[model samples]
Target: MTVPDYPRPPFKPQQQSFPGKTDKMDPRPDHGEDSYVGHGLLAGKKALITGGDSGIGAAVAIAFAREGADVAIVHLPTEEKDAQRILELVKKAGVDGVALACDISDPELAAKTVESVAERFGRIDVLVNNAAYQKYYESMEEITLEEWTKHFNTNVHAPFNLVRLALPHMQEGASVINTASVQSKKPSPNILPYAATKGAIANMTVGLAGLLAEKKIRVNAVLPGPIWTPFIPAGMAPEEVETFGEQTPFKRPGQPVELASAYVMLAADTSSYTSGALLTVSGGAATL
Candidate 1:
C-alpha cells in the first residue's frame, strides 16, 4: 500500500482530524501526565501560558501544576475544548487552572487577559509564550498575502504582545519561554512562513534576554523537532504526516513528555544562570 501520513506502527486507518487531537487521536500523545513528579520547584508561583490547550503547552501545564503553580491558559476558540481538558488536567495536578478564551491575534485581548491573571494571582512569576500558527505551501506561488500575515500574527505577534504585557507584572525571578522550531534552524520549502516566524522567535528570545536582564527576568526559546503534535496533521501534506520523523536519527517523532523536563529546569532556579539560549529537543538533529 502507498505510505500514509504519520503512521505509528500501522496505516493511517480512519482516525484523523485536521490539526489532530490528544483525546481523539489514536495512539494519543504520550504526555506522561500521570508520571510527572513536582518538587515544589515553582511553589506559590503564578504563570501564564499561551496555547496551553495541547501538546507542549499542555505538558508544561501539567508540569507546572505539579510544581505547585497556578496556571492561566490563553487560547483561541478552536482550542477551547482542548483548553478545558487541559484545565482539568492541571487541577488534577493540584494547582489552580483557568482557561481564557480569546483571539490571541488581537493585542488588546492579550493585555487584558494577562492583566486580569496577574491581578487575581497577586503576581505573575512565570510567562510562557507558546502560541503559534502555520500555513504551509508547496511553493511561493501557493502562498497568499492573507496567509502570510496570519502566520506572522499568530506565530510571532501574539508572543510579542504577551511578553510586552506580561513583563511589567512579572517579578524579579520571572521566566519567559518561547516556542520555536527546528525549522528555525533551517529553511523548508514546504513551510516558508512557519520557518521564518520560528527563526524570528529564536532571535527574539535572545533579544528579550538582553533587554530584560536589568529586571532580573530571563528569556529563552525551545527548538522542537518533529514532534507528534496536532499542528502537523493540521498543517502539512498527508504524505508528510505519514513519515513525520523519518529524517531524525531516532527514526521517530519526539514526544511532548520529553520536553517538560527542560521546561521545569528553566522555570525553576535550576537554570537561573541560563538565559537567551536555545534548547534543542529534536531527536538528535543539531541546532543551527
Candidate 2:
C-alpha cells in the first residue's frame, strides 16, 4: 500500500521517558475527560494499568474511572507530572486512583506491583499491560545485547509477571489487555527488539486466552499505531517527533482519547464474548 502524506500539527510539550507526559504536551492530548459519558458501565470494578501515567494508558485510566471503576496506575518512578495528573484525572471522574512508582522491569517489583493493586482494590477485574520501551539504532548490527534485554524485560516479561501475580486475585469475568504495537505487523527499520517483543505479546495473548478459558477470564491485545505520545518525543529526534504518524492513512496522529472507547468497550460487559482477539487501532496500518 502507498502510505499517504499525513499532516503535522502545531508543536506541544512532550516527555522524554516511557509513556511520556500528557499535561504538558503541546495542544495536550485529547483524553475525552469531558466528552466521555459513563452509564455505570464499570460500576465498582477495579483496573490496574501499567504505564497509566500518560499516553493511551492515561486516557484509558480516565475513561475507566468515568465508567465507575476505581483505578490503580503503576508508572516508572521518575514519571512524576504525568503520574500526578492521571491521579487527578481519575479522581475528577469520581473514582479512586493511586499512582504507584516502580520499575516494572524488575521481576520482584512487578510482582509487588500486582499485589499492591490487589490489596488496594480488594480484587482486580481488569489488567492493562501497556508499558513498553524501545531504542532506535541506525542498523541491525548496531543493536546491543543489553538493549535487546531491556526491550524484552520491559515489554514482554514484565507483563507476564504481572499477569501471573494478578491471576490468583482475578476471578471469572476478569479481563487482561496487553498493549501490543503496530510493529508486530508493520516492520520498522530501527526497532527490531521492540517489534520482536510485540510479536511475543501477540502470541501470548492467544496462548493465554486458550489456557485461561476454563477460568472464564478474557485475554486480548490492542495494537496501537503511531500515536502522539511521549514515546515519540523521548525516543525520536525533535524533527522526527514533529512528523510523527505522518505515514498513516489517517493523515495525522491519533490522540489518546481516540483509544478510550476501545478500552472501555473491552473492559465493560458489552464485550462479554470477546476473547483471544486483537484490537487494532493502527491508523489503518491493517484492517480489523
Query: Best candidate, lDDT-wise?
Result: 2
List runs of model 1 lying over 4 Å from the truth: 1-20
How much is the lDDT of residue 259 in candidate 1? Answer: 83
lDDT of each residue in 233-283, candidate 2, tens digit only = 766656667667767777678887778778888888778899999888967
TM-score of 2: 0.91
Best by TM-score: 1
- Report residue 156 deviation for candidate 2 (angstroms): 0.3
Q: Write the per-residue lDDT of candidate 1 for residues 158-252, one digit (tens) a residue.
A: 88888888877888989999989888988788999989999999999999999999999999988888877777776777777777777888777
**Candidate 1 overall lDDT versus native:** 0.82
Q: Against the hidden true structure, what lDDT does model 2 obtain?
A: 0.83
